[model samples]
Target: MQPIVHPVVGYLCYAGYVRASDGEAPQGELTVVAVFAAVLPDLIDQPLWLIGVTPVGRTVAHSLFGGALLVGAVGLLARRRGRTDIGVAFAIGYASHIAADIPWHVLAGDYHELGFLLWPVTGMPAYSGVKSLGTVGAVDITTLWLEAILFVAGAALWWNDGCPGVEVVRRYVG
Candidate 1:
């Protein structure tokens, strides 16, 4: 998925977490950070591919270890300020981003089959039966529609429940 889509999904996922945890949704800056964390893994991985790391090394960044480190590091920092919830929220959003990206990448064929899905259990690449999204041959009208809906939903969440404080944190910390 593109950066825009990743962040939008991240916002929605964070909204869900906030609503469930605090009986209120996150707004403003929190939305921004959540979106950023959601796409952070991608940011870490793609550039490395250009440098070449075999299929296995490329998959490492996308795996649980790398993600856990990201979440843990953020959590540790947030703990100093008594904002554990915020750190957890970012981690959750990041996990959600990875989860959401998998299906589409599988469908696209552009995905590296480097066993990212079976972390801790098997380090071998796992191939699925479905064709990759990139292998769809012609235009993917359905994908475009799905992306549009997700974007609108994310925007609506931000407009309705944005918190200026959260945005501030994201801008400074993220």
Candidate 2:
């Protein structure tokens, strides 16, 4: 998934979950955590891949193990802080990040790339990743179309939820 799609899908997923749970709009704190969690895998793996420890984008941090660790850490912190709701939302976002990655790989015809989903359970394989970050932002056939679809879905959901854009940022994301 594109970088933007990660957070957008995560936010929308969490927002829908919240709305379905009750009649309240998603709170700013949950939005912040969800967005952060959505991108956390990339933030962790990208730097590691640059340093040459991991093979590529879908290694280590993109694994289920990585998602569990993130969720465990956040869940523990939220528990200690007496904020289980925060923990739940964080897990939802983080899990969605891991889940969103699976289909993107499949769609791109990178079935083997999904080995990273298992990580330590399977030995890491070496594959050359894109040499430039520009590749992601560039007008690629696969990602561009996928991104368009995801963005439309995300925007529609946000608009339906009353477009809590700046309010979420001001109250929490900032």
Candidate 2 residue-wise lDDT, 1-174, digit = tens: 777788888888898788899867776667778878888888999899899877676677788887777789889999999999989888888888888766655655667767877897876565434222224455545555766788899878777767664586765546
- Residue ranges of candidate 2 with Cα displaced over 4 Å: 123-143, 171-174
The TM-score between candidate 2 and the true structure equals: 0.80
lDDT scores of the candidates, listed in order: 0.68, 0.77
Q: How many Å off is the CA of 49 in candidate 1?
A: 1.3
- Candidate 1, superposed: residue stretches over 4 Å from native: 53-58, 105-114, 119-141, 162-174
Q: Model 1: per-residue lDDT, tens digit, 55-138?
A: 433355567787877788999999998988778778877887778756665556645553575554555454343342333468
Which 10 residues in a row give candidate 1 its minimum summed lDDT?
126-135
List, in order, the clash count of every candidate structure: 16, 0
